[model samples]
Target: DAVDQARNFQEMLKFDGAVLTKLDTDAKGGAGLSIAHATGQPIVLCGVGQEYDDLMQFDPDWLLEQLFE
Candidate 1:
């Protein structure tokens, strides 16, 4: 549901990139892949925690490794 909502927003706004939040809580991160695929946009950043400094740049290879882990 959230992924679809995000995809719609991305499509409507034509945003440059996606910022996936709450990554620290999403252990599997299946939704992240779905959103990325559906949006057809690069995930430029990820919010790992509530703190501002917890955000990190999204790397495709790194994310793939994490997903498999």
Candidate 2:
């Protein structure tokens, strides 16, 4: 696998939002957060469980709505 590719992609990016899969299985979401931030990316998505597609996409404006809601 291209481990370097992930790193390279991380390095070249400025600050793209990201999503991490398998968060339940993942330990404290540390690795995913680390990798995303390490690549200069902000995590904007997360998985809630072990389903095939149990993802939660964080919208930037969602925060605004929540605050107003």
Candidate 3:
């Protein structure tokens, strides 16, 4: 196994505060939820659009609601 070479995603997790770019979409927001939960981190922001100002902060519950709705 490449366990020794495996890099921890903690830095990415801490830096992101939950808003993962790869999962930035209306659907499948669950992916972000899972990552945050698994890493025991909180989601404070999300960039769901293609603009600097589009990047916005969100509560975990609100993100979940968006996905659910």
Task: Please tell me which predicted candidate would have the highest TM-score against the true structure.
Answer: 1
Q: What lDDT is obtained when candidate 1 is compared to the true structure? A: 0.83
Q: Is candidate 1 or candidate 2 better by TM-score?
A: 1
lDDT of 2 by residue, 1-69 (tens): 233555777667744766767765753555664676466667788776777577778554643444455
Clashing pairs in model 1?
none
Q: Model 3 residue 38 lDDT?
A: 64
| Residue-wise C-alpha lDDT for candidate 1, range 1-69, written one tens digit per residue | 978797789878988877889988996677887887888877889988899998999877877787788
Write out the backbone clash pairs for model 2: none
What TM-score number comes out for model 2?
0.55
Which runs in model 1 stand beyond 4 Å of their true positions?
Answer: none
| Per-model TM against the reference | 0.81, 0.55, 0.61
Stretches off by above 4 angstroms in model 3 are 1-7, 11-16, 22-26
lDDT of 3 by residue, 1-69 (tens): 111111246644344455555336545576666666666667677777787877777656666677677
Model 2 C-alpha lDDT versus the unseen true structure = 0.62
lDDT of each: 0.83, 0.62, 0.58
Q: What is candidate 1's CA lDDT for residue 28?
A: 67
lDDT of 3: 0.58
Error of 2 at 42 (Å): 0.5
| RMSD to the hidden true structure, all candidates | 1.5, 6.9, 5.0
Candidate 2 local lDDT, residue 42: 72
